[model samples]
Target: MPLVRIDVIEHRRTSEQLRELADAVQDVMLETFAAPARDRYQIITEHRPGRIIAEDTGLGYTRSEDVVVVQILQQGRDEAQKRAVYRALAERLRERTGLDPQDLIVAVSANTRADWSFGEGQAQFLEGRL
Candidate 1:
């Protein structure tokens, strides 16, 4: 299971656009991470202009208000798979949402199966309920 958090500047994109972006990310996860189809979990947060600060970190690229930050908390995946997911996500976002690759920042934080509880205070993955 991957819990994705998408952060973007407020008023930068319409709701439909944001939904498409989320779908694109989830598609990449499904393809490269082999996550279950029913395991879709995501949170989208919109921040005011100054509230979200993203710097290029000397990459010689400038970020605009359209910048999107995708943070995925998921079970460990191999480096190759992660790389493929990143590339796929960027490409898909560009194609589906017209977001420039430089405007998208993706991060994956590794977690264990025990870290999740689907409901009723139960760790479904650990208990074989999932």
Candidate 2:
């Protein structure tokens, strides 16, 4: 399962818009990342203006106030899968939310099954409950 964290500037999107954004990302996770059905886990945080500073890292692209930063933490996805998720997220978010591809930054990290615990003070994945 991928735990997604979407960060955006405060007041930049309406409540409906935020829901659409999350749905778009979840679609990519399910389709491209191959996450299990009903396995959605997302956290959306709205930061005050100027709170998020994402430079292009010399990529020669400009970011607007509508920039979105998506961080995915999961296990067992290879580079090709991760790349597909990035592309799918860009396309889906652009089509669904009017977010510029340039304004979107995606980062993925990996962990082991022991790293997760859905609840009950148990590592469900490690315990074979997942």
Give the Cα error of residue 45 in candidate 1, in Å: 0.4
TM-score (all chains, Cα) for each model: 0.96, 0.98
**Local accuracy of candidate 2 as per-residue lDDT tens digits, 7-111:** 999998999999999999999999998999999999999999999999999999999999999999999999999889989999999899999999999999999
TM-score of 2: 0.98
Which candidate leads in lDDT? 2
Question: Any idea what lDDT model 2 has?
Answer: 0.94
**Candidate 1 backbone collisions, by pair:** none
Candidates' C-alpha lDDT: 0.90, 0.94
**lDDT tens digits by residue: candidate 1, 19-104:** 99899988988988999888799999999999988899899878889999999898879889889988998899999999999998
| Model 1 clashing-pair count | 0
Candidate 2 Cα outliers beyond 4 Å, as residue runs: none
